[model samples]
Target: MSTTYFISDHHFGHKNIIDFENRPFSDVDEMTSNMIAKWNAVVRKEDKIFHLGDFSFLNKERTQEIVSQLNGYKILILGNHDRGRPRTWWLEAGFDEVSEYPLIYMNFFFLSHEPMYMNKQMPYLNVHGHIHGQKYEGRHYYNVSVEQLDYTPVSFEQIRDSVVVDEEQA
Candidate 1:
C-alpha cells in the first residue's frame, strides 16, 4: 500500500538556513544530500507526500533537480518564501501539484504552509509548517516542520496514531 506523507521547510540551496535553523550541516550541499536521503529512507516512489512549503531557496532548475531525486508523488502548498514564484512554475519544476491556499484532507486535516486559526469548537486538525522548531498549544494543531520531524516525511498513519495517543492521554 502506498502511504500518504507530510513534510515542510526543506529550504534547499539556502546556506544561511544552516545557522538560522541551527541545522546540523556544514553547508548547503551537505544539507540537501542529508535531507534527501532522510526523505527517501521512509518514502517510497509510489507514496504521496504533501510538502507544506518553504521547499527551497534554489532557482527552478536547481529545485527541479532536487525534486527529481526524491521518491513519491509530490504536492506543494506554497509557503511565504515559495509564493514569490508562480504556481505554474512549481508544477513545471517537477511538483505533481501546487496549491496557493490551504487544503482539507480526509475531511478532517486542514493542511497549510501557515497554521490557520482554529478553536476547540472547530472539528478539524490543522497540519502545517513555517514555524520551524516551534509548535502551537493545541491538539487540533500538528506541525510538520522538518525541525519537528526526524528529518523524514511523516506518514498519515503516524499522525493518526499520534492524535489518538494524545486524545487518550487527554
Candidate 2:
C-alpha cells in the first residue's frame, strides 16, 4: 500500500523565514530547492501527502511550480497565508481537498495551521505546524519536520501509538 505523509510550513520562496526561524538557507531559491529535495528523497509517486499550509511565498506561480515538482496525491489544508487566492489554484494543483479547519482521521485531528487554543477535551490528538517548537502542554500535537517529511504522509496508527506511549508514561 502507498504511504500517507503530512508536512507544513515549507514557506518556499520566502527569504524572511531564514531570519525568522534561523534557517540556514541564504536565499529563497536555495530554501525552495532544499525543501523540494528533502521531500523528493522520501516521497514516491504513489504516496499521499497532506500539506498543512504556508506552502509557498509571495506568488501563486512560484507555489504552483514548487507543488508540481513534488510527487504525490496532494491534499491541502489551507492556512492563513493562502488567503486572496482563488480556490481554482489549489484545485488545479491536484490537491484532493482544501479546507480551513482540521481534518479528522481515526482518533486524530489534522490541522494545517496551529489552533489558537487546542481543544483539550477532545479525544483526538492534533497534528499541526506553524509554531515551529512551542509545546502543547496538556494537549497532543505533532511538529513535523520539513527536512524529513518529504512526500510521505504520517499514519494515524503511528500517531496513535506515540500518543499511547506518552500517555502511559504520564
Candidate 3:
C-alpha cells in the first residue's frame, strides 16, 4: 500500500535560505540532492506526498528537474513565496496536483501552508508549514516544515498517531 507523506519549504535554488534557516548544506545542489535521497528513502512511486509549499525559488525548468528526482505523487498547497507563480506553473513544474488554499484531509485535519488559528474548541487539527524553525505550542498544531523534519517527508499516519486531540471539540 502507498503511504501519504507531508513536507514543506524546500526553497530549492534559494541560496540565502541556507543562511536564514541554518540548513546543513554548502549549496543548492547539495541541498537538493540530499533532500531527494532523504525523501526517496521512505517515500515510493506509489505513495502520495503533500508538499505544503515554498517548494523552490528556481526557474520552472530547474524546478521540474528537481521535482523529477523525487518519489511519490506530489501535491502542493501554495505558500507565501509560491504565490508568485500560478497553479499551472506548479503543475508544469512536476506536481501532480496543486491547491491555492488550505484543504481538509481525512475528514478532520486542516492542511495548510501557513498555520491557521486552531484550538481545542475547533474540531480540526492544523497541519502546516511556512514557519520553518519556530513552532506553535499546542497539540492542535503540527508543523511539517523541512527544518523540523530533517528535510525528509513524514508519513500522514505518523502525524495522525502522534496527536491526541479531544473528540469532544467536534
Candidate 4:
C-alpha cells in the first residue's frame, strides 16, 4: 500500500539554521545531506509527503537541485519563509502542489505551516510545523517539525495513532 508522510522546516542549505535552531550538524552541507538521506530512507518515490513549510532557503536552482534528490511526491503548505516565492516556483522545484494557507486533508485534519489554536471543540485536528524545537501539548495539536520528528518524514500512520478522537467525531 502507498503511504503518506508529513514534515517541515527543512531549511535546506541554510547555514544559519544550524546556529538559529541549534540543529545537530557540523555545517549546512552535512545537514542537507543527512536530511536527504534520512528522508529517502523512509519515503519511497510513490509515497506522498506533506511538507508543512520552510522547505528551503536556497535560490530556486539550488532548491530544485535538493528537492530533486529526495524521494516522494511532495506537497507544500507555504510557511513564513516560503511566502516570497511563487506557487509555480515550488511546483517547478518538484513539489506536487503548493498551498498558500492551511489545508483540510481527509476531512479530519487541518494542515498548516504554523501551529494554530485547536481544542476538542474544533472539528478537525491541527497538524503543523514552524515552531522548531518548541514543545507542543494538546489533544488536537500534532507537530511534524523536523526538530520534533528527528529530522525525518513522519508517517501518516504514526500521526493517526496519536490523534485524539472525540466521542462525537468517532
Candidate 5:
C-alpha cells in the first residue's frame, strides 16, 4: 500500500545551511546522506511525499540526482528559496506535482510551504514548512520541516493520529 508523507527544507548541497540553521550535521555530505537514509527507512518506493520546499541548493544535475535516490513519488509545494527555478526544473527533478500556493489535502488539511493561519473554527488544519525548527502556538497548524521532524518524512497517518491523541487529551 502507498502512504503519504510530508517533509521540507533538506537544503541539500547548501553548505551555509549547516551553520545558518545550526543543523546537527558536520557537513553537507553527511546531512544529505543521512537525510536520504532516514527518508528511505520509512518511505516505500511506491509511497507519495509532499515536499514542502527549499529542497536543495545545487545545480540541476545534482538536485535531480538527490531526488532520484529517495524512495517516494514526490510533490513539491514551492517555498521562498524555490522561487527562482522554473516549474519545469522541479518537474524534471522528479516532482510529480508542483504548486505555487497552498493545497487543500483531503478537504480537511491545508498544505503550504509557509505556515498559514488556522484555528478550531476553520474547516481544515494547516500543514506547512519553511520556519525550520520553529513552531506556531496554535494546535491547528502542523509544521513538517525536516528540522521539526528529525530529518525524516512524516506520514500523514502519523499526523492524523497525533492530532486525534491531542484532541483526546484536551
Candidate 6:
C-alpha cells in the first residue's frame, strides 16, 4: 500500500510570518517554493497528502499555483483562514475532499487543524496542524513547519511509537 502523509498551516504568501514567527524566508514566493521542494523530496507521486488548513495568505489563484507544483493526491481540511473561499475553488484545485472535522483511514484520525480536545475513547490517532511544534499535550499531533507546511506525512504506526516513547520517558 502507498504511504499517506499529513501536514498543515503553511500560510503561504503571508508576509507577517517573518515578524510573527521569524520565518527564514524574506518573502512569500521564497517560502512557497521551498515548501514545495521539501514536500516533493519526501512524498512519492502516488502518495496521498492531507493538508489541514491555512494553505495560502492571498487568494485561491496564488494557492493554486503553489499547489500545482506539489506531488500527490491532495485533500484539504478547511481552517479558520480558509474561510470565504468558494467551494468550487477548492474542488478545482485538485483536492479529493474538503472537510471541517476528522478524516479517518484504518482507524487513524486526520484533520487539517487540531481539535481542542482529543477523544481517547475512540480507536483513533489524531493528526493535525495549527500549533507550530510548540508545547502541547495530546495523544497525537503534528505541528506545522515553516519550511514546508504540509510536506511530511507520518503513519499511525510512527505516531504510536513516538507517543509510547514519550510516555515511557515520562
Q: Worst 10-residue stretch by lDDT in candidate 2?
A: 145-154
| lDDT scores of the candidates, listed in order | 0.94, 0.69, 0.92, 0.89, 0.89, 0.68
Q: Across residues 1-170, which tens digit of lDDT does each residue of candidate 4 receive?
A: 78999999999878898999899999998999999999999999999999999999999899999999989888999999999989999999888889998998888989999988876588677889988998576667788889998998999888887664533355
TM-score of each: 0.98, 0.84, 0.95, 0.93, 0.96, 0.82
- Model 6, span 50-167: residue lDDT tens: 7878777766676777777888888888877776776567877667777765666565554547654656565455566676646356555545443334345554456567767866
Lowest summed lDDT over 10 consecutive residues: which window, candidate 3? 161-170
Ranking by TM-score: 1, 5, 3, 4, 2, 6
lDDT per residue (tens digit) for residues 1-170 in model 1: 89999999999998998899899999899999999999999999999999999998998999999999999999999999999999999999999999999999999999999999998988689999999999999799999999999688899999989999988998
Query: Of the candidates shown, which would achieve the greatest lDDT relative to the real structure?
Result: 1
Select the stronger candidate by lDDT from 3 and 5: 3
Off by over 4 Å in 3: 165-170
Q: For model 3, how does the per-residue alpha-carbon lDDT over 1-170 read when each residue is reduced to its tens digit?
A: 99999999999899999999999999988998999899999999999999999999999999999999999999999999999999999999999999999999999889999999975677578999999999998678899999999998999888887774333343
Worst-scoring 10-residue span by lDDT in model 6? 142-151
Best by TM-score: 1
- Measured by TM-score, how close is model 2 to the native structure? 0.84
* TM-score of candidate 1 versus the correct structure, residues matched by position: 0.98
Give one digit per residue, the lDDT tens place, for model 2 in 1-170. Answer: 78777788787777787788777788877877777887777778898777887776656666667778888878787777765566677776556677766777543565546644566676666677776545556646776535334423455456667788888988
True-structure lDDT of candidate 4? 0.89
Better of 3 and 6 by TM-score: 3
Model 1 segments more than 4 A misplaced:
none
How many pairs of residues collide in each model? 0, 6, 0, 0, 0, 3
